[model samples]
Target chain A: MDYHWDWLFFFRETDDGLKYYDWILSGLGWTTLVSLASLALALALGSALGVMRTTPKRWLVAIGDAYVDVFRNIPLIVQLFMWFFVVPELVPDRLGMWMKQDLPYVVIAVVGLGLYTAARIAEQVKAGINSLSRGQRNAGLALGLTEWQTYRHVRLPMAYRIVLPAMTSEAMNIFKNSAVTYAVGILELYFQYKQIIEKTSQVLEITIVVTLAYFALAFLMNRLLAFIERRTRVPGLIVGGKGSN
Target chain B: MSDFDFSVILENWGFLAQGLRYTVQVTITAMLGGILIGTVLALMRLSSLPPLQWFAAGYVNIFRSVPLVQVILAFYLILPMVLQMITGKQMPIGAANSAYFTFTVFEAAYYSEIMRSGIQSVPRGQVAAGYAMGFTYGQTMRLVVLPQAFRNMLPVLLTQTIILFQDVSLVYAIGATDFFGAADKITQRDLRPVEMYTTVAVVYFVICFTLSRLVKLLQSRIAIIR
Candidate 1:
């Protein structure tokens, strides 16, 4: 067998190849959009669930626990497919048809990815909130702040700062998982890569390019998250010291 | 909806069973393959040589960053092309059927990081002790370090197994008739999405739930041993 290396295939002006590359970029755009939307939703839902899990009320804690358990245990693709296929059918007929036909796929993608990631983020937030001293809560109560006020003004901000690093990893995980949306035909980066490979038969070139794109995005995200984490570092906390306080 | 029929699921139980078997097979194969490959990568990353460490690190970073679906797609589409290019012949059906090969290689990149962390978590003092006792570095790693590291890694391994089991479904995109693929075919034919998907979901839940409990038991046992 003979081996020939063709680096120029990636750079050459080929119609099918260029179109495939364009499709991949479009897919990357959708991936980024879905990931950002899901990140927003996860933050909102996760914070509420996290706060509720720490609530003194029995029913709220139970509700929060059940929500986390259901989402955390299920496979993400199952959840995505369920939402995409089963969910629309369960709705009232008019609404169902609208969702199945007119409603945007991106919305469903965001909901699926967001809700799943929220379960994890909730746990991280709960840990972050719990890591603080009981004295802080008592101090807020002692100062005559209402429960909601205290949390809004003091506890949440602190918890958010503490959980930033964990949240960063969770966000990255969610972004990567969002690629599964391509299965439902969302035309995300991976989906585009598949289309490209099928057309040009330049499987290796497309894979290498797409892989590099993913790495660049993830690396940038990590740096951004690290920056946020550093900015929020509690004064006097040992920055890089290991062995857990 | 009353249209949701239990009878359909009951009638299709045999097909579902077949799918479940295939899913389990893929899961087991992928888990074992991934763990073996991941362990080697982990050791490579931990090696004294810079190039090996760099290569392994790059592998992990690239695979981990890309979505698993992309990795699977790459394996399905690219592996065949590359194979044909090198061998001057079409790849074997057996290699194609065993999509677990791709799943395992992809998963290994992630597993290596998991294993590396577990290995690193072992106290340096243990290695020093092993060295003092005249054990070579390889001997110390094999006899002293890895056992302790594996013990520490039980829970993570279990979690990874659960993820791997779920990932087996992605192979369906490439035409492997795993549990999800079977369910998809059934749903397409029977037009009973609710019944078929619910059955599929429950089957997955039970397997994952059982494995999770097993993980907890193993963790407790490891705790006792430590």
Candidate 2:
């Protein structure tokens, strides 16, 4: 019924000649890499989808809606499995072979996570754009600006600022969701924790450390976003304030 | 591409149905437990006591910061040890049972945030009005404020539940036989990864998509009432 706790197991070396801590550190690196790369993709694709969703064209809006609905409905793990196992087969033979044999798990994870998260971010961006006054769009048109120019200049900047808070949560979510990559055998932080625990049988200590690592990452992201929100606060433009009227 | 086999899914329909049943069961149990615990946490966060506020805040932040899969794995590994320590005997918490407990605790963090916002959306006058009617603090919350808050946040709560339903798949990390886990096992045994995964994806999509549309309709109806 008793257990021996080893707090120093992280300093020990594995059969692969790397210190246990080094493996964990590499896992952290992969997690960060996956999150950053996916975040970049999500933002670009999501912004485009969001704009499409809010457009006057019916077909474009339908396409955007379908994208969001499909991606958002399916769970991340299922999507990851689809990307890893099914997508390679669906492509051309040479490319499929490359994906199965040569493509890195990191790239697959990035594409899967990025596309899924883009659906969520697209919703946020759509809401942000919708929150702006209709007059803002009309005023841009009155200034003899083209529709594209009005969206580029008048709509997107304010919409981005307005959505910063929502985006903050999404960013944190992406980091947490990166752990799903572990299911596909990616050597991320969660995977490393599992590896260390399995090898050393020091489950509690490793769990605490891994939990702290995730907490620190999320806390840092929260603080960073809050700072940005403060810096970007518009004079008379407030978000979610009580009794602003 | 033209030679897709739909017969495999039909053959395994019973197994898949059982798995879906387990998935829905876990989702419902976790949703109920989460909302129950979340309401208490919400009240704790809103309470005037600093310790309560800190405890609630820490609980919410820790759960939100960590991934659910990690949490599930940790619980699956750690629960047995904790149980043994308490009872001075080995007590193995099976994967299915552990999934229920872990999902409830993990989801409470999210539900608490939603409940907190729901509580805040209530007008301050409602509380004063409750007091004006000669009600105590608990009476005020239990009777007036909570009912209205629940109504106001129903759509959001339902939307979060839809997410919780999807998240039940992650219990596969612990080898729990939820819907996704069942599919994974079949794929491994039958070597039909394409069909198994596609069917799983379509099932999840149909269920989630329908629920989301319902939530949207509810949201519009709520908006109109307001």
Candidate 3:
């Protein structure tokens, strides 16, 4: 068979005649949903771990360090699998049964990607906090503030601001990384891209369209985050938005 | 842990060994190839010429934004078709080759960013000093700037290397029998997804965690105060 271009392949249904383009729109919907949900999880968990790492308690620091190490070094795809296949089996009887039967790929993707990305965010958050003057921590303690209060009242707000630019990159990365959720049978954009190609056999055109779509999403996401970062940036910290890849 | 058995992994050492070999081979080759392409892109990005800068930036942006799996799939699925049309011949690229090419090209975007930041980390006065000493731009960059820059960013580069190693597992998606792929085959065969996945995760953690600690030590050793 000879190669042929089919620009209108997305409009074509599967042999069963399911609406094709709607599949793509739904996939895009899931991708956005998974990314935003995962971002929320990551920011909350990561900031906690970051604060823990800098605390005076030795065990807390170790636990935070171990969490970062365990999550950061593992492949995200593997984590997705663990959450999907293994995690369900480990839960108690009724819940495990329900999970195996009804758990959504988007939920698993959110948890998996959130935990994995949280490690990197923790490091960024820690860096942002460490860059602050030690005097701030001292001031908080001198004011009779507990460690939690110090972190909440004095450290985390400023740290989040300092880390905003780097965090923007992480936010953009999560959206791109959400593509891997397709591995666990999530019908996200990549899965739909592969599905359309498998059905129509127009590999080149479909792949180009998908690639450009991803580029557009990433570009827009970057612009939005950069604007927020610019607004939240401190008066004279030299950490300009030199983006990482 | 109760259901886990070491004998399964022990009996499958040969399979894992083969997978490990491919992993090392792919990682090293891609690291070298990525560094080469990335250095060029970084230089182009930092160049005085506007077109060169824009071209480099655009290339990095596109590649970085696309997920690695999509890029890998595109190469595996799309490139051969384009090659056939251009050459009028059916040239089949195998999974391993496609994985290699994809990782190299995809990773160059990340490495380019690292290299650009590394190069920028060098003090500007060094280049000026090189010029004052009658050195050409190339001589200044090669002799004075890069040495210090590499030292300054060695930890960051090594950190990225760890990240690259973690990402190599994505090769499994294309059925390249790397470390994760081998585990996956056994996992499917034995229906021991948890055990196999745990083993794979532990192996990755050990290798990457140790290397990161070494990088941290090296970072402290070679830190540039300025």
Candidate 4:
């Protein structure tokens, strides 16, 4: 063996019989919480902005474009640092103190991750909406529905279905992105992994475990979304447009 | 708020440029390495041989599913130790080299997928016709398919490059002074995290936004209008 491998490192007790595995599980909890919270925020804001981007009005589309452009371009770490250090300072004194001192780092991670992923999600949603035939939108309006109602009743459902494949990938992307929350001091999986490495010199063992954990997370998300995508896929919509005939 | 000064940007331009150079260096080097490796991987996945196909599939799945930071970290911290053990000597790889190598391998997975699709986008007829003209499979792909596939995937390749640039920021995890790392150092030094960090964000936004615009323009211009 080129290296000594400790197969039971996760089972090793740190204090009072509490194994290192406990810390990892708790970190997983935080990672899941931040990712789920960010997913919710990204979806809500992304759909709104996505709808705005596809609307007939120029300014609303412009607002949507600007939001995606600004947020998507900035690195998530830089954005998190801004949310952590800059946003608090720009706010009121008490709020600043609260964010600086009291507000949990996980919450800040959620905000940063959510807003950042929202930009990418918005683009996916817009593409989905554009993929739908114009007749769908026209039909809804022709049936005496208002534009919002047409979008809500006709466009969004189909758009969501159309983009579900892309959206699934984005969901996995955000889960992976949540790993960066370590920079903000959230003791997520990566943070726990780092702490473990600091205490134990079993670098390869710990990295393999953590990397597998993330791979499993992403794989499950991809599979689940793919399942949903298959179940919800409209028949005959797969042929797509402008075939090079 | 008024006391927040942007003067630090100019003062630290030299320092920041050094970091920026590393960022650009890694990106360009990794992109070229990735494209070459990824083209091979793409061919593997598309091959009739079961082992090559399976190996390529497994490679893509493993790399794509894991976060890039962890990959970077593994190469940075673990690879050197492994190297030392294998060589029976202390071999301390620089953080920049580790990052560059990791990114090259990591980005290849992504590039493989893009190239796979780009290859698929080229009609079967082209490959068939090449073979019909007495070309070997490699010759067909090299002569007929790849040139068209490259044109087809140009936009996606550039988009991935833009993404590669953003991800270079993560090199800071291993203490490599990429662009974000340099700014981080200034923020720590000047005790002005907000100003320094915001300025860094602005630079990223402007550069990325402008490049994305260029990407869009080029995408439209080269769109294979059938």
Candidate 5:
């Protein structure tokens, strides 16, 4: 075999190493920002929909169900493309032009990632809320709390705690799915790697770096979530056990 | 705009049909290949030896952590170069086929984890009974454990298949002319992105919705068996 290892090329400036490194770092920064923003959006939207899904009002339940079903059924990439390319055109001319020109790519990334992941997150949040004992809600009602106040004071915290694991997985998924932004010309880590490989033809080295970088970042995110889980764990509930892995 | 334009679809029927065939082929190939590799990885993960478990963990982690598109792109670009160096022969097919192979491999990683969970969900008593009845460990796994595990895992396996079907569209990035690529091509050619994509989306919805119902039916049947 005549395969020559070029591991050194990744580190040496003579091979445009600095430029590649900078590109990758910036990509990682955007990826992190997009993931965090989307995580927040998904949590907020998914929670509201999830709560509304359990509402006694028929219309509210219908709306929540429709939101979940429509978004969940569609593929994320298709949705991203539609939002980035098509949605703007449907807006008023001035607003549409401004969105096409001035809207940051990260904003599109957040919307795409947030809405796509929200479907799954909604399911998780609903599961968490449903898993709580019925008596808990009743007790809140008995204490003179309104339906909304009962949920706010009693159900939400417990549901959030119970669903931590699933939420972590969902967040991880959103982070990974952010890679789809590359299709819309966002220079995230995966896109950066693609550009570098195409330019330098150092395919293996660039791929290795990209893969390692993604794995490390994902691992760190998992650990961070795990830490939060540990810190916020209910005292009498399930304690440290084997990871879902 | 015309409420319906049958002629545009009729004109592009050949391309769309070809894309559908490729999409179905990729989904089936990935499903079968993923299940086989996934079964092996699940067994390895469940093995008594620490090294085997660790190796399986590493494999799953690497594939699961990285984005599927990156994997496809890597295999498309790097596989041929490495193959050339080793075999002194060019890979006959270009980047697109390699991307399909990558999708299959990546799907295997996720499928293995799902299978492992299914295997672990099997009651330990079944394996013990198999051993008591003179079955070896492998026989216990194959005859006793796996059958039940598979039944338990049917729903998840079906979900994975649906996801894999959707992921077949990613081959578009590497120029494989699958369903999404065909839609994209039509959009570019006809300058009607909305109509083309809407058609494609409906096609995806029909397939996915039907598969999900099938999954529900399988789950009910499995419940009856239990």
Candidate 6:
């Protein structure tokens, strides 16, 4: 317990002229950017895949299942490595060169994280759809809606509502999972911990600060999502209803 | 541009196999340890005691909020210092050993949540029935409640283990030579990122996908029994 505790170390300027805390703030900025961008991509693609899995067509179901199996089965760090290092070489020469040399690391990190999370979200979406009673779909059909139209107008809206809380959890998950982007050398918050510790050997301080940053971010995200959940709640729905707990 | 050079994989089979063994070892160890500790935490949370509930809730929330990679790194840095203070001796547990400790505690937080739901899923009437039969609370929990709860949670617990299996690869950040780490080492040496990464990805896919299918099968069987 004889270790010297330097609380003011974060205010000290670094070689880049920015204070260490400022550098950490930029890392937090990258983390937020990657998480939000990737979450947007995951929601769009995952909803489509989820709907595909529920369709009557065998081929669409197979495609959806395959996407989940492939993406969900592999560890994310390995996937990030492949996306960063291996994917570029597999493409056409000009496109490969562009991906390798010109594309920002953030885009690759986002795509990798987005694709991986999309698989998990697709499962959630599928579960939400399945949880709805048969009458919901039957009512849509009886109302003269086509299958696609039924999903759009009737099923998806309700399914999304029922699964809002779970989806919110996934939103929180992506924020934490964004830390894995450090593997691809994105300068996110967790990555900054490494950089700072290496530079100053302030391992304990850096770890504590970075951990607190994540805690604060997650707490705020949870509150914001809970507010959104409450604002959009359906009175008789599973999430906000009396029977849920 | 070049042919897929899986020859590197075959050439390094021995090294790769050892690494895969380590991955499986950590997964099994952490899975068992997590569930053990998690069950205790679950019971603590479900207890009527306020202090016990608060402690369990705080542990689960804090662990769940932070990223696993950060926790892994934090433990990697902090465990040695803590160990030194406790033992009054300098003892640096290496990356691989620390991975064991960190994943167990980290996965416990997640496992506790699943177990909590499992416990709650058991009907209150069942507990009442246990009490009517003159069973004490501990006896009722051991004989009646936990068995049913564990059966209900088996598929979910297994699914979590599959996730734990994949997450063990994160130990690479601290330089542990698990399966992915082994592949990474070979890739760095042979400079064949494509072959090494593809092989590792396929290996992970085959194992995890098959386990997921089995879990689904088990779930259906449990549903049938119920």
Q: What TM-score does chain B get in every candidate? A: 0.93, 0.98, 0.94, 0.96, 0.94, 0.98
Off by over 4 Å in 6: A235-245
Error of 2 at A197 (Å): 1.0
Order of the predicted models by DockQ, top scorer first? 2, 6, 4, 3, 5, 1
What value does the lDDT take at residue A113 in candidate 1? 90
Candidate 5 regions with alpha-carbon error over 4 angstroms? A11-18, A239-245, B1-7
Q: Pairs clashing in candidate 3?
A: none
The DockQ-based CAPRI class assigned to model 6 is medium
Query: For residues B1-226, what per-residue lDDT tens digits would candidate 1 score against the true structure?
Result: 6577889988988887888788888778878888888988999999999999999998887778887777776777666666888888988544336477787788899788888998999999999999999999899999999888888897998788897888778775676777888888898887888777777777787778778778888888778754
What is the DockQ score, from 0 to 1, of model 2? 0.80
Output the worst ten-in-a-row residue range by lDDT, candidate 3 chain A: A236-245
Ranked by TM-score, the better of candidates 1 and 3 is 3
Name the Cα RMSD for model 6: 1.7
lDDT, each prediction: 0.80, 0.91, 0.84, 0.88, 0.81, 0.91
lDDT tens digits, residue span A1-245, model 6: 66778889999989899899988999999999999999999999999999999988999999999999999999999999999988898998899899999999999999999999999899989988988888988999999999999899888988887777788788889889999999898999988888888878788888888888998887777788778777777776556233222
Instruction: Quote the lDDT for A138 in model 1.
Output: 84
List where candidate 1 sits over 4 angstroms from the true fold.
A1-18, A239-245, B85-88, B94-98, B224-226
Q: Write the per-residue lDDT of candidate 4 for residues B144-165, one digit (tens) a residue.
A: 9999998989999999999999
Q: Kindly indicate the candidate among 4 and 6 with the higher DockQ.
A: 6
lDDT of 5 by residue, B1-226 (tens): 2344667777887898899888888888888899889989999999999999998899998888888888877788778877887788987668557756887788889899989999999888888899999999999999999888888898999899898888877776677788888888997888766667667777887778878878888888778764
Q: Listing every candidate in turn, what is its Cα RMSD in Å to the true structure after a full C-alpha superposition? A: 2.9, 2.1, 2.5, 2.8, 2.4, 1.7
Candidate 1 displacement at residue A36 in angstroms: 0.7
lDDT of 4 by residue, A115-224 (tens): 99999899988998998889999999999999999988899888898777678789988878998889889988888888888888788899888888887777777787
Return whichever of 3 and 6 wins on TM-score. Answer: 6
Off by over 4 Å in 3: A1-3, A16-19, A91-95, A230-245, B85-87, B224-226
Q: After the best TM-score superposition of candidate 5, give how far the Cα of residue B111 lies from its true spot, in angstroms.
A: 1.1
Q: Tell me the TM-score for chain B of model 3.
A: 0.94
TM-score of each: 0.92, 0.97, 0.93, 0.95, 0.94, 0.96
